[model samples]
Target: MQLLKDQERSQRAIKALIITPISLFIMISGFLLLKDNHFSQVATTLFAIVWGTVSVVSFFYSLNLIVQVFPLKYYNKIIPFVFVGPAILILGWYLFIPTLRSLYLSFLNRNSTAFVGLENYKYVFTDRTMLISFRNTILWLLFGTLFSVFFGLLAALLAERSSIEKIGKTFVFLPMAISMVGAGVIWKFMYAYKPAGANQTGLFNALMVAFGKDPQNWIGTAPMNNFFLIAIFVWLQTGFALVVLSAALKGVPNEIEEAARIDGASEFAVLMRIIIPSIAGSILTVATTILLAALKTFDIVFSMTNGLYGTEVLASQQYKQMFKFLNYGRGSAIAIIILLAVSPVIYYNLKEFNKREVF
Candidate 1:
């Protein structure tokens, strides 16, 4: 039995080595052929689709064959890896490799020809525009996230008790369907400024005119303009928060609320003590998700203010450094900074998700 088992193991190992290389060669060759420019666009697309489908099926079939050759005792141990291993490798290739390359580039000069040590990082911390971006990003993180979660929670609660729940939610959620740039354009018209004497086209300016006040440049006003930009983020993200929190609210048991009320707890107390706590996990999840969005906000600032009027955020600064100014080092440094800033929140979010068994 032992000699037979050894022979089986040798056979399986040889088969595995042979099958792996052949499968990879075929997949890679097919991919190259599909990518060749000799093919027309339509032919390339059709070939790519067919090639991808065939490659996936063939790879899985080969993987299953390899797994089956292994003894039954090892089948369970290897099966999970057989399926998940490809994804892990793909992620490492795509995400991890690029990240390391960026880190290396961050230490180099603008054109990545020479080493700059920490100079780029110092510029990121001390530059005047970068300072403004940091301040604005903080405002976005605090106010944008706060208002989105607050209003979303309020809307969810109100909608839960209202007769026109669907209609109200539909209206409130409509802004989420619009792209961030589109929203900025729409709101730009709403915030459009004209000379005090000219007819106000903007809704806010028109309101000011109706009240006999001066028409203000909403996007051009410093400090206060930051809040207006933050408002756009809130409008875009609140619907997402509302939908998530609304589902969480439904998951709370009605029995707990009734019991608290029967024990003479007021509505406010019951809500604060019972309902909110019950769905606290979901709320944290929503808040963290929005927090990430706020941290990475670029489109609204880009479209509306172009980072002008003191509305610069981290992402906008990164864009300016990388694309506009072509400073790879500074851009990579700023990107790493943003990554560090959001990593802790992401960790916490994933931890909460794990506690809830969301995976």
Candidate 2:
């Protein structure tokens, strides 16, 4: 009873010590407002300085006491909180609070003063730019990620154990190292045009002229331009998907492949039945990753097409709203849409991971 009492007393003492300086700082800062004009400014700055200084000092003191109070035997259990507490607080401050604030802002008018209810969300559904944004977003979701995953998986299967596999893989994975902006710049040049004989710097137009065809503005067309930009994203991301899927492919047991061959399975049949099924988990992981990347894509589209030719995605549209149009409410609505859309992806990925752990 005495030992338990002593422990409880020490804990209470430590907690009190930890909170005392924080309370003092707040009180002193509040009291500084009562001073005269010149004195008040000086007092306020000093109050801020003192508040910051004392807070840091108190935090370290509290941490030191916490380490000493918790025994070495229980340190492992206690250390995680010490390490993760600041991160959790920061996440709450930056992610959770900002997200809640944005959602609240979304319900307000453009100036963020009036309660506009669902006007902003309604604009998202009905506005021409937003409708185009949704259509382009769907195209990116369907074609951008799908082609990357498909080509990646196909490449993984094709290059499994060939003699030149390493060289082929090195070539394929080269694009993953480049930044999205750099990839866009490179492809921009590739699709460049200058009205038939004004230097022919653009590779696509150059190729066309070589075939005696007129130089055309490739990135200015309607649906075709969208696909061309999507192809750039597909090229950049396929390398990442290929590398991960190929690693998973390499993990498949040799006995399984040999058994399939012994059963007189065709090469294609073996790949379809034995290999793909075995790596389904990895495939799903890669596909989900690519889909998420596609959903959040802004830099590639902004750098390449600048969301022109009716190619605005949700991310670019969010930027266009907030920065170009200066409509914070609509911008926040678009941001919330993206957050909600990604929340499901994130939840599914987490659930999938949990399922994998169980199996």
Candidate 3:
């Protein structure tokens, strides 16, 4: 009897092992069938059927494990997802299929017919507008992030001892809570300008007029308009910078500051030598986050200047190409180009943080 039971248990184990590997192999092979364009339709359908089978098999396998941990009473909860099976169907319809389609579309032509074979990618590198947008993207990565970090650091330093520090921080962080579209609209009003003669509603133009300078069409200007648009991003980002760096600043021990002070260091010298070094990791983290944000920024340039007048960044250019021109290949190329540019910086920053363990 014992030998018979042992053989049965071993058989069950082998069966589980066979099912798991076979299920996974089918799942993977379903996707590999897409190598030929001629097979794309069949391969796409195969993916859905094979993936669904894998999911059903894997779920039962995983369900037994989950049952051991979660109480039996909660088993009712799992039954609902089983009933509404279509939430998953909706995800494939809205998210997964569309994403796969876009990636596939990247290989096709401007009209999405007769494969262009990376001509769009070549334009991403060689076209004047795309190149200009790339340069502007770099400027945003550098100056936009730097300004946000600098101002946030300054605010954190200046507000550390204030009675109204909460108020000051709240004001600074208010922009962060606002949606990007809202911030863009707000900055539009701030940068609002009329022709030199009419009364200006724009805060910037009002200030210019206050200084007796004529209110110019700020958005219509060359290269400098890009800077003006970038400023809006910095303004919105600085508060977040301040909050994170301020927490980091507080971590710098008072003993170190006191020792620097006792050694006859000026306040600025103490901040430079003690505070700055103490918070360098946090500062780098904030700067990298800001760099990512600036790289991805679309609404500010879109709302303020619409990628016109050399204010184009990759994100805005991608939107204009995909949505406005309906050029899927060019749009996907722009996206891939921006991803290629920023991915390294982001990867490096992630590696540096892991090396430092700053978080």
Candidate 4:
């Protein structure tokens, strides 16, 4: 019986191994054929939809068959790979491989042909524009994140108590719908500058003139201009933090707050000792999310100031090095630096999520 069972398992394994390759080959060949043959736009779309659905189903079915070929003892362990293996492979191919390539390219010269070693990294730290970018980015990370979370938590608390909670929250949250570039363009007009004697067109300038002040160049003003950009980030991100923190606040037990109040705790004391501590995890999550966004801030700066007048962030600097200057080495080095800067935050965020069983 044991000998017969072994023969049967061997036969099944051989059939699975053979069939999996043949199915994959046919799947690839059919996709190539479909791609190569020109069809009308609607017809091509239809074919692609059908082919995609069929291909996914067939591929997963083949994977399951391969997994089933394993012995019973290993079946549970191997089965998970049938579902997760494709995602792992895709991430490895697209994300991991490119990261390694960027690291390698960071060591090369401008043309990516000759070895330059740490010269690119040296320039990244020592270059005038790069230093300014680092400063501005740090400001963005600090102020942008601080104001966003602070205002968001404040709004969430206020909205929870307001009679017209939905209406107030809706108005505050509406900015979250605007794209960063769209917000930048809208604010650009608000900060638009003209000669002092001329009529002010920009909203801020017009307001300044209304208040008997000169229409100053808002975007052109160094150091402070970065804060103005940070304001846009705060505007866009605050709504997100509000929604998340509001939900988290709701999760805090009312009994705890009531108990604290019964014990003669003030509103502020209750907030500090009870509510905030209870929702600390959510606040940290929101802060980290905003921090990552601030770290990678590019669209607004690019759209409004184009990294001019000390408004440069790491992302905009990387863009300039890659496209404007066509310096691959410096670009890759800056890219790696940005990656390294964000990696710790990402790891911390993931660790927190793991502790919370979020995944």
Candidate 5:
């Protein structure tokens, strides 16, 4: 009986190996034929649906068949790989392939029809508008990340001690419920300006009018407008930092803080030296996350100022290059530069995540 079972498993494994490739080839050929217009539109759609369904079923069937053929001890060891392999492949196909293509396109000309080497990169670094965009991007990263994290830390600390903790946090986090574009629209109203003698529809302008001052075009001001734009992002991200850092703070042992207090440490010292140090990792994590968000901020700026009046950042500039100016090379180069700038932060963040998982 044992010899028969072994022979049957071996034969089944051989059959699976043979059938898997054949099914895959058939699936690919069917799709290719459909793409070649060998079928009507309705038929083509049906064929695609059938092909996808069969492909998934056949893949798992083959996987299970192979697993059955393996000895039980080896099967247990290899099962994790069988499930994880497909996801890894999908992730690579979606992520790494496009990144490589973008990098290749960055070295090409405007239409991506000819090689331009580093010309696009040089323009990104030296062009007047590009330089301003770079400066604005740095400003956004610094101010947006700094203020968001600061306010978040403050909110987390204050909320933890508040009688109405949930209600207070819910209100502070209310802005987060608005989409970035929606928040931009709401703030646009807040920052809206009318002539000094008009009805003063904007909230800020109305306040100024009530206080006997003129209405100002807040977003039309050049460098100051950039900071005004950064404020919108800070408002949006503060809640995210608050939530993450608050969770981290909760994880810190109360015994340490109480002991510090008993040793004659002031409240300021306890927070500065004890609580902050205990949750330093979480702080760095939240800061890096907000930094990345600031680096890639587009919708808020695009919706509000549309990169006008010297409020452009790298992402907005890239959008103008690719869509408005139709300059693929310069756009891709800017994108690559942005990617390179954020890659280190992303790497460090991931490493910290791994460390947290390990410990």
Candidate 6:
């Protein structure tokens, strides 16, 4: 019996040694072939897809066969690393490496030729436009997050009792289907300004003209215009907030809510003292999500007003500094600042998610 077991283990080890290298070679060869355009482009694409698919299938199969050579205890320990190693490597290569490079570039000059320490950060803090951008970003974080969560909570509360909950959710979630740029374009038309005598193409201006007020440039005002842009973001994000918070709300034990009502607690009291606390994690999740979005807002500002009219945010300023003005140092500094601002909220969000998972 001992001799038979030894012979079986040796045979398995030999088979694994023979198959693993062949599987690896096939996978590499398939990947190389997939990158080539020597044949008709469509035919090459199709062939590569098949080749890659088969290679991956065979590779995994051979990997499992190789794992059989290991004892059960060793296989269990090694299997997790085998599955998770590629993702860790990819994240390090793409995210961690690039982030370090950006941080290093922040101390370099515009052409990245000379080292100019602290100058970019100084410019970011003291520049007039950048100051306005900081103020506007605060406003975006404040009002955008507030109104979005507020309206989302309101919608969730209302829809929970409504017969058409699914329909209501669908309509509210429709705006999320549109990209930020598309939403900006849609709202841009709504806020378009035309002179009093000519036809008012913009919906808001036309309504104003019908009410006998003169046509106004909605996107040309200073702080008020900033709020207008924030409104657009709120409109776009409220649905997401609603979806998440509503799910959280649904998770609240109905017995607790009923008991509160039975104890003579008002609906408002129940909501404030019981319901809100129950789903506080989800609320924080949505708030932090919107907060990050507001901080790094660029697309709507870029597409709608191009950050003119005191509407700049950190992301827009960074983009203009880097691409338009060719101020790479300043751009990198702004990016670092944005990352710093976002990191705390990200940490809190992840912590909340992890806590929720544990519970």
Tens digits of per-residue lDDT, candidate 4, 1-359, equal 88877787788788778877877886897689687877888888888888778778878877877777777778799888878989899999999999999899999999899999999999999999899999999999999999999999999999999999999899899999999999999999999999998988999999999999989999999989999999999999999999999999999999989998999999999999999999999999999999999999999999999999889999999999989999999999999999999999999999999998889
**Candidate number of the best lDDT:** 4
Error of 3 at 263 (Å): 1.5
Q: Please give the lDDT score at residue 157 for candidate 6.
A: 90
lDDT of 3: 0.82
**Comparing 4 and 5 on TM-score, the stronger one:** 4
Superposition error at 241 for model 6 (Å) = 1.1
Clashing pairs in 2: none
> Per-residue CA lDDT of candidate 3, range 87-140, in tens?
788888986787667767778887887798878888888999988998899888
TM-score of 5: 0.85
RMSD, each candidate, Å?
3.2, 7.1, 10.3, 3.1, 4.3, 2.8
Ranking by lDDT: 4, 1, 5, 6, 2, 3
Using all chains and alpha carbons, the TM-scores for the candidates as numbered come to: 0.88, 0.81, 0.73, 0.89, 0.85, 0.89
Taken over the whole model, the C-alpha lDDT of each candidate is 0.92, 0.85, 0.82, 0.92, 0.91, 0.90
Local distance difference test, candidate 6: 0.90
Span of 10 residues, lowest total lDDT, candidate 2? 30-39
lDDT of 1 by residue, 77-190 (tens): 999998999999999999889889889999999999999899999999999999999999999999999999999999999999999999999988999999999999999999
Please provide, for model 6 over 139-189, each residue's C-alpha lDDT reduced to its tens digit, 9 standing for 90 to 100: 999999999999999999999999999999999989999999999999999
Candidate 5, residues 257-309, lDDT tens digits: the string is 99999999999999999899999998998999999999999988899999999
Task: Give me the displacement of residue 351 in model 5, in angstroms.
Answer: 1.6
| lDDT of candidate model 1 versus the reference | 0.92
TM for candidate 2 is: 0.81
